[model samples]
Target chain A: MTTMAERTRTTSGAPGGTRTLTLGKAVNEGLRAAMRRDDKVMLMGEDIGPLGGVFRVTDGLQAEFGEQRVVDTPLAESGIVGTAVGLAMRGYRPVCEIQFDGFVFPAFNQITTQLAKMHNRTRGAVELPVVIRIPYGGGIGAVEHHSESPEALFAHTAGLRVVSPSTPQDAYTMIQEAIACPDPVLFFEPKGRYWAKGEVDLDAEIGSSTLDAARVVRAGTDVTLVAYGPSVETALKTADALAQEGRSAEVIDLRAVSPMDTATVVTSVRRTGRCVVVHEAPVFFGAGAEIAARVTEECFYALEAPVLRVGGFHTPYPVAKHEHDYLPSVDRVLDAVDRAFAH
Target chain B: MTTTNGSNEAIPTLQLLDPEGRRVTTRGTKGYRDRAATLTAEDLRGMYRDMVLTRRFDDEATSLQRQGELALYAPSRGQEAAQVGSAYALRPRDFVFPSYREHGVLQVRGIDTVDRLRFFRGSDHGGWNPYEHNAQVYTVVIGAHALHAVGYAMGVQRDGTPLDAHDGTAVITYFGDGATSQGDVNEAMVYATVNQAPVVFFLQNNQWAISEPTTRQTRTPLYRRGEAFGMPSLRVDGNDVLAVYAATQEALERARRGEGPSFIEAFTYRMGAHTTSDDPTRYRTTDQEEVWRRRDPIDRLAALLRAEKELDDDYVAEVQQSADELGVRLRAGVRALDGGAPVSTFDDVYATPHGVVASERAWYEAYEAGDPPADQYAIAETAQGGAR
Candidate 1:
């Protein structure tokens, strides 16, 4: 098994004019740069101040920006997002953090109904440029609500842009870009890979890396493996393992979950002729489900086999001891790949 | 804290005028009475005219809905004073977040009656631009906009608008007793108080939320709920236009001065059913209706005007003529409103162009146009080459 540090080293292979940073640190630097660039950019969430957030993703931000800009709100998710709505109306870009994925439901009404529709309801007279950051997915075997992959819930909603970053570079750039976006953005940070290191170019044009564009991380001819967030790393590993065999596998990192960049996936699938979708979320009605359905529809003639999916079962995210069994492991992804080739 | 008199019984619903159209001045509301006295006869007359026009508009909308011109109508029949008075107290720069039944408030905030009709008429979600009149679109989901108002008020504070200078910038959020039960409203109050936001939570306790009474929503007086959240709150005679205006003006002043959020529970009643779809007789009795009918806000003001010799048969007839004209205009405008949905329903789903949305929109358009499956499946041209 490759350690996160070894995998990170392999992934972040960029040479000149780049810095090696863990995904968390890269995001911190990105937030600092965004706040420096725009005075209207502010942070609001629980434990984000002093404690530096439950995951410390916002470490040292309060000290740098002062208490006003990096506000530590009470334990109220709804209020945090709800107030962000008002602040946005008042011409401020508020970046709200939901400590965990499952906890976001408390503020779902505000996010879906208020923050999402304010633009169209006002006939574009008002723009809610708010960013809601949720740390999601499972790997370290956290308890129930903490490990849930609820991106599909957000993706189902209109008026919101849902994106997840796999590599540190994407995390560094995506957070800043999401903040700069004119519409509301639901940024899903892969907490399982928060410490994964990657090379990030600080001087690169910010928001130039199109978030909604799916990128082919690994190229091959035999099959296309589609994944996002935590599963992207797993899919990449599966692709590497498949390279040792006679089969050649390609990997696509779906950075944008909602408003999915399926065109890239379809193009890859057309050449590969076979594909497997992977994610830590429930396979039923998940982002992977949508990707599979989309691939079949768009690349129907191009596919040699039906698109297969590797994900968690429909049951609740299990306890720590059973997490690995529940989550989509590299073996399971490869099995799905082999099944695709069986046809 | 609760706005209680020395005896601490919660100052018996502050009122400047009785139901019988007589001035009943009390020590608790003396300050407001003084403020009301500053208004000339013309100003008072203007307020009366607005109330009458709003009622007329509400009646016309209700009729339109019944005639199938509108999809639905949320009536503000009895709570006109509560909405109009607070609305009139607002400065042009101040923003208002209203629950669905604030047709009168929309009128006071410069949104045309025709523009307000767009929502019910299904022509548009909200026809007027919020920036044009400093009023947000009507929020149908109860208590949701309360937090939005808090957030906006917090933004108002950060914009360095000089809160203490009375630069006419603040936020007012409207909701009913039922909405206070929602976590969003409570959370909004939490943020508003913590941020010291320049927001006034104008809760028109219209006694019933649809069919559920205020008692079902809260045990203590609605005003006391704010006290628990560390907000200074007062109960006002929502039927008394002068009292409602005075109370709202004071709250706005407090907010502008950076005194944090204030709660005003207007002790009003929903004279009509919750909406045109509801039948109040099934849930409420006629005796209750008769009791409230005697305290009609418009009639009380008219009585006061007649007693002061400021109103005559000629002036009454003129106001009725104006109301008739407004009704005619509303009827014509609503009937002429387009009932067809737009071809681009997917537009504005996101401010920026999204590939999936673009694809879906194309599919929908083709389907609506009765195109073949091959044509329907084709993806639309992706929106510009920009950051997604």
Candidate 2:
């Protein structure tokens, strides 16, 4: 299932200086741009070179940059990330890719214990400017191990900057920003939205926003719906459906998960007075719990009701046949929104 | 190019000097002796002094830990020859990544005893700058830094440095036999060989991985495992300083020659507990300890020096005097340390400032200053740029 065709041409957006591309292709352009700008940028991952990538996100990178820059590594996840750590220490910006979400655990020790702590452990003598890209969250009809959300695990880590992108423009811009960061960044790509097309300008201004800031995707006043990665679209859809029912739900896309832009989130929650969190990961100890805790403490007086959560059950991501039920959908987000209104 | 027996199978071990301190010229070790002979009597005496001082420092640190002056100590008592010999073969520019027990290696790299002891004294994570000494900080997690070394070597190669040249620009990483079982180590071998990275994997098999013996850690010989990854592998008489030095020198030469990675399994024993927290008596027998004691690296080196008429009473007294001075300085330095600022914890979490960490630091400061619970969150909220 490898595609050899190189689609290098950019498509124009509707009446704007932007281009419409899939989230995966936007990421491909972002990587290409980053490599073009910096000679020190290198890519390493399994099936990322000749085969482009499992999702074709790295299509034609190896051919354009040569195998030295875009390497097709062995099927060892820990090896990929660990080597990236060394390369970073040696003054190279290595952008590593973990093929699947569940496969990231093999490299967890290196990521959490070594890469995350190297800067702090060395007392700021060394900066690990490495970006670990993982295709996370479920909604695609993929089997187990292929689709999962382990963002919370990395977010819980102290030294790592965890972020996820919900749209093509974000996927394109954030990937480049994460690469330039001096600290180690865990960039979670929502695999389910890889094929979702949106407008992203190839020549857009760089560094327009720090990769860690949250954005208000859709504005309303009655209540706020918070989500990231795969769940952001569902929350927006819930807002659209809620508007018909006169609920006027505000949706916040939490692009940065770790040094979480709780300021923006708390600002929206204060205005809306009610909040509902949506996520595909299990609710217990997931990003929802963190958002709920932060909103409660920051907007204690402004909150009209207790925050509600709509997310996957506390179990492993199910088989393809039942994945739709396993993932947080528009109805699920709306149900949580309804619960917040009822309270 | 490690020496092999005539049978077309690799020799299980290469010992240039036997335990009795006599240089051996057997078929398996014959080639290395000539390399070892390049070192003069003065050079050998330096190695002896290094091993002796390192051991004395280790002993004093262990006692300091027991006396509650330090948190804990990983003694490099019996493994000094392995650490010192291999480290002596490296140039100042060659990058070195070490596991926690490479105090001897640190000493060889000119790491100040005070800065090194601060880590064990609970005053610092790793006090010395790695870049300052061409050595990375102590990596406690086993086999993790092997990948770092390989990556660094790969970077060296990418920078257009000729691999085969003796330009004093190679990489060497040290880990224990127990780290062999780690996936990162195995993955590091794969990357090193595939990229033909200019690096050497020095495995100090000190017999025990804490409570487990070398046998429990691996079934076959640890050096042979490197062969499976297509790396040139050899086992050395770790306690024999000359043998280890020769093996490491050859390994470094091979790495510099653009010959990918080399693995040196320094066969030795840990004469003390794994750390200050372990009790060796519960896991090892006295007979086993006695067998390794007869092969003490320092004793064997001392015997070799004495037989050659190089270690006279005056030299012994001078070395003793230096070791005594080292102990006095280490004790005074540790006591003089202020244990650093308590708020320094909020520093270095990220190279760039982070909103979350800043808020948490503010909250911690307010709490430490006896702010009530409500005011602490208010301070954190203000610090994080949240609207109150």
Candidate 3:
């Protein structure tokens, strides 16, 4: 029997079901779903209004909601989130797209100081319920200050929920849930994965990803392959390839980066006894490091072979083909799997 | 059309006083002495008090940073007047967004001074709720918070959120000269203008971006930079708390009246390093510092206070005592914060972790149940059960 989740992505534009949809499109669909259900939903970004966006993620949004709702903003990232603080004060749900990952740094103040911890900081007087969408990761091979996986930065902030989705389904569901929640959320969509295709059931409302939960993408008895965002697809491919080798690798998708769902991961690790974690960011202090450390601590006894990490080299995401090598690959996952088996 | 300081070079920018502390009024004989026409003396005196207290706090926080009580501190010594004046000018309902260094502005907004310290101390991200005092948290990043302010202002414009013109809410964001270089800063202006979001872009032009000078930041005047983005720009004397207060009030009122966005460049100087990690002497000279030193805002206000005898010696002593007490409180707060303290913070990953995080949590649980390595980071080297 074929379950609904077993279908391959045939119709695709972007994450929200298009072959050509950029990460920007997936985010647009997320915003649309959230806004359609709740009038309080609004998006603000630089060039996000009449101009669509520098990347055009917010194209035609203002027209749908009017200029007052979809704000174009004065090239002020800090102000965008800063005023989102105010809008949320008046009971409006603000979804701010930071345009680019590198650009998001400027608004880090608002995100870290204000948006990240508004609920707890205010003693629950203000429920930010704001979604800050940032196009992250390095695959476009753009210039300096373009491709970066600063998820660790956000994940390191308290009082803010951090989640990343690898598929259109997750994107659609999670974006809506983010708007519905009373806490602030940092929604990081891989700029490179925006064009990836996936099926979306418009009729079904995907509820919240457990505030902190991990999902097993593939069932396996040997090694648990863990990753999220763009890395999840890679891990999936790696798991499929591993299946051909008769090593049923369990794949875990880390939809939430912070307030990490260690419980689910530990259960998977305890079940598999072996694990290989992966991510696109550098290994030094990336999300992969935190996952590897915590998993080692939580799933310590369950492991037969040691836990290993497959991630980008400890260097700045280089240009062109170098970036391809820089990012973890199926071969890297297999190699980590080999190391785990040898142990 | 050719407005200048009656000079062939156009005076470069407007000025009510040079660094020499000499009164150099702009066009028309309204003069610096009569600058108070737009501001009340009592307001000016209150502004002075705010500046003094903010400076005291700023200095105390800086000490905490140097003493390892804080990870970093962006001291706004000279820019106090700019922040306090601009912030205090806003209506209670008006929203304020500030860069990391806006402690003075936070004080003006009734922010718990300890809250700012907690953030820098790394005790917790931010300790205050923006809505509690009608102010947003201090964004440590460059200028992105300005765009959020713009978006919120857009929300305000959409909700028909405000009925009365003067009573309507307005958005104000504070950032340093360095932040103007950020893409979000430029984009914020474009959006705010086209949408006509009732927002004010408060740029504190303190003439330095870390070691980078203001000259390297822009070829044109900072205020005029807003004009290119279709915003009306004003360059005001940042050191004069009265001027900052008056200019900010005017801009906020204009914003509330559907006047769109305005950029007010608070022409001030940064008396301290960008943060504790910075060394200003490497980029600027003592002589240059001396130039701004003569333009001491606090001294000028003190001069004005003395000239009018608005404050007696006893009152000044009481203010000093209050400042000292605040310093002790901050020191105590800083002393209480310890490093390597367990902390977990996620920026804003919007999604509530459902599967992936849950799996990791489960893995961590069982792993912890089994004894881990002697050293946490040495996971690979020290096997869980074997090492334990």
Candidate 1 has which clashing residue pairs, if any?
A: A86-B151, A86-B152, A87-B151
Error of 1 at B365 (Å): 3.8
Q: Which stretches of candidate 2 lie over 4 Å from their true place?
A: A1-17, B1-11, B28-30, B372-378, B385-388
- Best model per lDDT: 2
Q: DockQ values for all predictions?
A: 0.60, 0.50, 0.23
In what order do the candidates fall by lDDT, top score first? 2, 1, 3
| Candidate ranking (DockQ, best to worst) | 1, 2, 3
Greater TM-score among 1 and 3 belongs to: 1
Worst 10 residues of 2 chain A by lDDT: A1-10
Per-residue CA lDDT of model 1 for A1-343, tens digit only, reads 1121221222221222689999988888778877876778899999999999988999998998998899999899999999999888878889999999999999998998888888888767778889999999888778779898999998998889999999988988788778878789999999999999989886655543486788899999999999999999999999889989978998999998987877788888989999899999899999988888888988899999999999989898999899999899999998998899899
List the lowest-lDDT window of 10 residues for candidate 1 chain B: B1-10
- Please give, for residues B53-121, the per-residue lDDT of candidate 1 as tens digits: 999998998899989999999989889889888888888888999988998898878788888989888
Model 3 interface RMSD, in angstroms? 8.1
Question: What RMSD does each model have against the real structure?
Answer: 5.3, 4.9, 8.3
lDDT of 2 by residue, B174-249 (tens): 9998999998999999999999888999999887899987767776778988899999998888888888899898
Best by DockQ: 1
Task: Indicate the docking level reached by candidate 1.
Answer: medium
